[model samples]
Target: MAEQGPHFLMVGGVPRDWRDKRTVAEAVFNDPLPFLDVESAHTHEVLSSAMAAELVDLGEGIIDVASVRGRNRLLTRAIAGAHYSGVIEI
Candidate 1:
């Protein structure tokens, strides 16, 4: 079974374990990353620990990309033009 989310996705886990099932929601926003919620009757192909790690790695990459993009944008703007910050005298 494959779980897809905003973060890393994996294709293995113990699916539909009643012991781990929940009524409302298994994990809250503060729970953590790589929340393994297998679908009913589905069998996971990956281990829980591995899935969590993969997800964390994915999230980290996304953050790194954002940081790099921000720096690149600032550099591009600096080279493209300038701004007048001080007030002009009448």
Candidate 2:
């Protein structure tokens, strides 16, 4: 037998705009917390991977962003630089 599809599809990380507008990276690293409510909710009300990573302080390993759009190199670099981890796509 042979595989029909990719066992693992690799992608980049979260976009700069998406993270800047949605996640609490700025607040966590800089700035002050005024409202303390920085969660970004889509139509389905689901937390983004970037937010989740920030919350948990993602250090390393591949980040699965299959549901997100506009993934690119800059996003990956930003996340990796922030966490100082080797973040890749899975």
Q: What's the lDDT for all of these models?
A: 0.33, 0.39
Specify the poorest-scoring 10-residue window by lDDT in model 2: 36-45
Can you tell me which runs of candidate 1 are displaced by over 4 Å?
1-37, 40-47, 60-90
The collision pairs in model 2 are none
- lDDT, model 1, position 10: 44
lDDT by residue for model 2 over 2-88, one digit each (tens)? Answer: 564644433564457755787655434475323212222331122335445553443423334432233455444454453334232
Residue-by-residue lDDT tens digits, candidate 1, 34-88: 4322331221222223234543543422222333245555432321222122111
Give each model a TM-score. 0.15, 0.20
Weakest 10 consecutive residues of candidate 1 by summed lDDT: 81-90
Model 2 TM-score is: 0.20
lDDT of 2: 0.39
Regions more than 4 Å wrong, model 2: 1-64, 67-71, 85-90
